[model samples]
Target chain A: MELRRFTQPSATKPTHTTVSNSEIAKWNILDRPLTRSREELYLSTFSFLFAEAVQYLQTRVQQVSELEEKLNQLGYRVGQRALELLCFREKLNRREIRLVSILGFIRVQLWKFLFKKSADYLKKVTDREDEYYIEEEEPLVNRYISVPKDFGQLNCAAFMAGIIRGALDSAGFTASVSAHYIHREEKSRLAFTVTIFMIRLDESVMNRERKLAG
Target chain B: MSSSRASTWNKLGDAAYAKSEKVSADLVALTYGSFVREIIKDFEEPDQVNKELEKLGYNIGIRLIEDFLAKSGISNCSSFEESAEIISRVAFKMFLGIRATVSNWNSEHNSCSIIFDENPLAEYVELPPEYTHSLFYSNLLCGVIRGALEMVQIIVECEFVKDQLRGDDTNEINIRFKEMLQEQVPWNDEE
Candidate 1:
């Protein structure tokens, strides 16, 4: 029993029809700034939201891998949108045509956009022609998440990998991306865990890269 | 006196917000959008999805209230009106970086509407025609409010009355006060 701002759905106009004619319909999303002028929400807000999402996914899937996959798929959707938004915002009129360039973009621009810092390291696997790695000291997604002992080798950073894959795949660089936690017990004094994203490009994509190089 | 109190809450909200660590808004918005879509895919019905979202928000709210109190240092609201003000000006700004306006108080002052033109959760979100009418895109918020208040002995019913994604000019959530829970003997003491 509150006063409505817009007109009520009348006999002449149905509820659905009014949506197309409304002010919201005319608004364009691309015109909006990618970043807000005001300060962003508390980091814990995102952490809590992410935690809820992981817990919800945990109920549906039987295995840890499946849960990670679900998280990745969700992150993939975000990554696709992030790529478009970042590209537009940065005024990068051109898309990366080569695999290496796209990888650099992910390591630098994409990471900066999401985490406000570039990834720690990017290296090609000397043994494999189509494999590469992007390393982070402690990924933002995994910062507060402490995986239970029973769910061994299940890294929440799979979501971050999915984001990377989504960006790469959208840029015409097909790759299978997964996240792994690299144990550094052998090192003398490494305090924090390191997450490495293993990106394996498809043979076809590698072929194209070689032809482009020629 | 009321205006001064409002500004004081705003300052508290701002100070609390500044003290907390922050992340990009788009990251939260996009992740939320993806999560909602996943729920819709799994639930396959708008009503069910709304229910699921609300349930999830409730779980978050109960836990989040402790963090809110500890960080904001906010304590006992003298009245429901003051609580509403804190929720709008302080809580929303502290967590979501947005300020909602409280209005349309009923005669008994037990019910009111919280309105905000901008929602960070709905950033770049365009609801499909099928969902525009049936779905409350941000139904999670209603649950969060209800659950958070419940932790403080305030039982209230919260529901989204209007959603901007549903073609409304702004998002409005109407909250009605229910009976305050009376103190009861602790379960441990009963034994």
Candidate 2:
């Protein structure tokens, strides 16, 4: 489709009102850079469109896993991109080669984006120096649906898993991100566990880190 | 195939984080695959739609490389091994807060192991009787990891070996790379 340049004389002699730059900026699509201020953005409506997207994909698929995978891939894209942009603008940290350093990034870096609140729970240990847990009383997205019999093989949050996976894969960890449901035996509250499966570093990586650190 | 769009979105996520950009504050983790799932979940015939959704993931994955770099807090990797650590922690951390642990290295250290101690998708999730072998609807993760790793020339297979609730709390998952990698991934190796 050839775009009709605005400068071209309209065959109908231009009936529409002249658009102001501000109006043009206001009409920008999401694919474009964010141009709206805090006030304008909050007032705008995009959920109807988002909701339509969800409904459209849900009905066309065969198995529930395929559908969830699709959502996860899309979410991974968003997560990967977000992580990149955040790192791009900000000063990149020297980086953590050890497990503790990596987990710290998740507890401090990743959790900040997924949950506005820092983990209400964090325990740092020196012995293993490789693990940390970020506690979320409730994973916001899982608030609505319950896993039923036919759809019991569904993880609505694999999209987040993709994000975690993409971020980890790109960062050079060869990490595996998995989502699990952890419902307390006693407590009424439920939490989704997003675990990053860290593998032992290849000798080449350890050597490189040694060289870089040295 | 294009990185521009994904990079642009990554910028949006950055802006959103920086308070300079604003997207809806609502939870967004379920939006992607759920939307795609919803599209094909009800089709009487869905061969074409499945093709398209995967194509969408491919495009998204290419662009994600940039985002992975930006949010990872590292300018570059020192080696393939360091690259692995960055991929696991920073990438996952920026997107969601899951840290996969790497362990059980081969004596020569060419290969290693990872254990999924805390999985977010497992939250409030119970596998139906039919999916007793694994977590339902989480294969996208297996696909996403496969796609990402293949881009870097790492050949791996991922699967769940156990589940805390599903398998008497002896639940475990195993992801092992093939000793040899084919240029082309298998059909099962798609997201």
Candidate 3:
């Protein structure tokens, strides 16, 4: 194929033209109105990128905890942005006021938007009132990842935990979120693998919830 | 015998290519574009942003080759031309769901162009006026090719020669093979 190279006229040249402030403002993504039912991105791309991110973090961090912390930090930033975006798109006029409500929101709304489906289970810790669990049989982030025997304790779901923490923190609920891998043997095919994200709300947050409820 | 072996490898590559999963192209483009935009915002310099994107792609490429090899069950390429064909036919299709054509072979046959009719990364993207000259929007692709080739012991220089986002006729990535990296053999204890 003959490559056709055309010279653009001076007025149409892309290089020298200055974009005014008005144009920049008009094109600003923040200024755009949030639309419901946005198109979904490719899951494979996300998986590949997440895999690379984990690989990159693995190389940088010496300890398993360090890698988890790094992943969590990365997810925290994403969670913050996702919270804002989800709220805007859903047109929610009020912030989540209760512990259960916010956790429900994360498990349902946030999960739906990010993964196109809700998490498998949301449960309260029997012994600890302040601790809650959001579980998934297969996490989207961990779809392509296979943890080695040495790094058996490492749950890549730490990124998701960070996202939960970031979202909760931004919503005025201070909490520590950690991801744990639970292995179960059952007769059914869906038996073995499960990732549970534990959310531990701070004392102040629990107190505030009690005050609001009472 | 070598031809038969090559055919067997080709069959494996085809099977791998066929078995690879598909995903939404829009998602890939938006996520990648947004990530690049975020990097650009952080660096606040186009050159630095390009370097960073390339570095990221290089990291991805190194790991991606492992996935590719495992999936395709292909161990080696007989020549640089064969590698180029495999990349265009099998690797790009399996990963990106886009087919690239290898063309414009140089006199020495060491250089060629991979032309993309459509680019998943540049979908719905327009370069801002200021970034037209400074940003090589898909520099990551070049880095990926370079990194993957290097892993196979083929040292190649790759660059985005043209982009549709830049009002070019088509998207073309030019690759020039420099040299093959020789494998180092370990010393035997008995020797």
Candidate 4:
């Protein structure tokens, strides 16, 4: 196709014709298929962009919770879309059959899609059957983020938590996901700090899971 | 420009440029392409997606310009030619790890083209046959350039004239200087 055929205006022309309805319909992006099945991005570029995003959010919001909330909101949209696309790609039964199964899907499938690897650990809380833990030694989202001393109790992983919440909620496994920093004194070779994502499913979801299992 | 000034600018560019750790080009390209896809999904309209991507690039550019200035220690360029050279050599090299050539200079020298031999952003990008008439795959680069220049008081109109993904031999961005902005100083009432 000729590059000029796209109807882009010349530098001399200040105004251009608006995209027509038929043109818009023909080029609807959502209707398009994935151009390539698997592709990767530079980790440095991702880190740089993520850092810029955090910096931008910091300038906009005042409180720690607000920052986290903004991050969560950003992640929420990603998670929702990821759930739909991933489910379609995997061809698994639309909704996960059981609670453990959903957690497993998130720990493995979702992690693989987002970070190219399964989460480090997936464990059920010792006393609370409803609470599950998805741990990552260095969450990809937080790999480049370094929370300052003044911003106490603020974890950028809150964005990842929001993603988990969005995915689970959309998949009919309603839950609350929160990220907690786990400081290790031994200091591994990797520079990133560890984080544990805690997911607490709603009572209704648990009941439904039990019912479905029964 | 004087020889001393030219040498000073070159020295600054050299000093400011650092070789950071390398990252997988595939990872960067895929993530950015996916983000563009996500934006398209949100808007559902190709034009809207393009506008949004530009707006997003502008926002990133406004802040990124500060980083560029600080890291490069470049206060200002003597002329549009100088600026174009720096952008193609220093700025692009430092950030994206790619060096673009400034070519196609107009007789008035108000406009030129930055040609990229390799685009990390379009490494794995493919334009589906149906959407060939639309979708500038690397539109974000145009926005970033425009936004960064705007922040530095160099108002320029930028566009992607050629995209390798669309079968162009090289990725080319055409930039035309609109006007040079004059700095305004606030007057004191007492004076």
Q: Which candidate ranks first by TM-score, i.e. highest?
A: 1
Question: Best-fitting candidate, measured by lDDT?
Answer: 1
Q: With candidate 2 superimposed using the best TM-score fit, by how many Å does residue B67's alpha carbon deviate from the native? A: 34
Q: Residues A1-214, candidate 3, lDDT per residue (tens digit)?
A: 2333565557866676765422432343344334512244335556777776677668777899998997887788767767876787678888888989999999998888767779999999999989999999998778888999898599999988988898899999999999999988888666687999999999999999889989
Each model's lDDT comes to 0.87, 0.46, 0.76, 0.72
* lDDT tens digits, residue span B1-191, model 3: 25575455456655665665544343355446555765676688989888877888887777678778777666776678888877876677666655677889999999999987656676546789889778888888888888888888898888888876666667788999999988666568577
On TM-score, who's better, 3 or 4? Answer: 3
- Please say which candidate is ahead in DockQ: 1 or 3: 1
Q: What would the per-residue lDDT of candidate 4 be over residues B1-191, giving only the tens digit for each residue?
A: 35675566555555554434334343455446556765666677777777776767676677677778777777776567778877877677666766677889999989999987667675535678855557787787777788888886788888888776665667789999998777665567577
Q: What share of the true interface contacts does each candidate keep?
A: 0.61, 0.07, 0.15, 0.12
Q: What does candidate 2's lDDT look like per residue over B29-123, in tens digits?
A: 33433443444444423444434444443434344555555544456543445544554544443343444545566676555544544433333
Off by more than 4 A, model 2: A1-54, A89-99, A119-135, A186-214, B1-191
Comparing 1 and 2 by DockQ, which wins?
1
- Each candidate's DockQ: 0.36, 0.04, 0.14, 0.10
TM-score each candidate.
Answer: 0.89, 0.37, 0.63, 0.60
Instruction: Return the candidate ranking by TM-score, descending.
Output: 1, 3, 4, 2
Ranking by lDDT: 1, 3, 4, 2
lDDT of 2 by residue, A1-214 (tens): 3566645766768588865433332332332233221211110112322333444456667888776766566566656655664464345766556544555675567656544544444444235323233344454444444557787656555555665566655566544444445444446545444422223333554555567667
- Show the lowest summed lDDT stretch of 10 residues, model 1 chain A: A17-26
